[model samples]
Target: MMLSLALVCDHALIDQAGKLSVLGIFERIWVERFPAVHPRLHLVLRLKGRRTEIGDHPVTIVLHDPSGREILRGDGMVQIGEPPAGVTEVEAAAILVFDVPLETAGAYHFNVTVDSELLASLPVTVSQMPAPHPTPEGN
Candidate 1:
């Protein structure tokens, strides 16, 4: 199997029809506007078939800070159906949502792995929107 997509978004959902719907997909976030550690987010990953994938596979999604420290880690089994021989590929997907402490602003990373194989690394930036300076005294 191979990684098809990895994303960070404000919201994500798998509809009843087996379709994935995502909103506010972004790589940069303004965190200081909200309370510290507020405004949780989601990480969504999609894997595609290469005819070698079958049954359940171990998948891990890890979030790290700019200092190379792990902020959070999530792992689970992804069930993938085997495609017929010499046939088109299929897909598997997973989602992890968590609140990150946004006390500081910097570059972060989302590392995604399938069966212990490094697949993708997605970059995310966290910065604060600068507050406006107080207006000078009016006449």
Candidate 2:
């Protein structure tokens, strides 16, 4: 029930037009466990940035299996807004949700991209079911 995120900032580059500047990249990975009856896997993604219109940009999520094979991919637009003052970090924010089959358990990789450019990659492990308890009678 915990979502772990890894934020990486590449070398900053000044835009030629001076309109915007590239600061850093952020990535997160987490495992979600649902009730046994739940039919799918839900992945929630949240991005936070400053002076960036997350809604105006395109965000994509690519899912890969253990062997680095792509299994599923999805894209969507985010709703961007300004963050409170004094927040030198990313001000805008975006959230993405991906649903997949729960039966699919293994090492999965996620690649996040913007404008066809690779931003970040994340790997996660999913477990199928909890181990059963043994009875004293050995039945």
Candidate 3:
């Protein structure tokens, strides 16, 4: 199986017709201070496989901090079905929601694995938002 798309976004939706809609796609997060909790974020992944690989595959998502320490781990499964007669590849998609906790400003990573093998590594950078300076009393 191959990872066709791996991204961080605000939302991801799949319609009734198997269409994907992603919004607020981003790679960086700005916070006002350290030890910030990003409320919500989505890790979207799209995988493609051959028709012969039709089955349930174990999926793992691991989040690592800037110092290479494991922060969070999520496990799930994806079911692959037979492709259409004219299509040779099957597709699977998943949206993993996370309330990311950032301890300090640096680069974070989300490592995606399928069936015990690493498929993709997605990076998200967190930086401190600049604080506003004090206004002068007299101009």
RMSD (CA, Å), each prediction:
2.5, 11.4, 1.3
Question: Candidate 1, residues 55-93: lDDT per residue as tens digits?
Answer: 788988888888988888888899988766777777877
Model 1's TM-score against the true structure:
0.86
**Candidate 3 lDDT by residue in tens digits, 1-139:** 9999999999998888889999999989999999999877999999999998999999999999999999989999999988879888999888889999899999999999998999999999999999999899895
lDDT of each: 0.81, 0.51, 0.93
Query: Top lDDT: which candidate number?
Result: 3
Superposed model 1: Cα runs more than 4 Å off: 33-35, 83-87, 137-139
Ranking by lDDT: 3, 1, 2
| Candidate 2 off by > 4 Å | 1-40, 50-55, 79-90, 102-105, 128-134
What TM-score goes with each of the models? 0.86, 0.50, 0.95
- The C-alpha local distance difference test score for the whole of candidate 2 amounts to 0.51
Clashing pairs in 3: none
The best candidate in terms of TM-score: 3
| Stretch of 10 with least lDDT, candidate 3 | 81-90
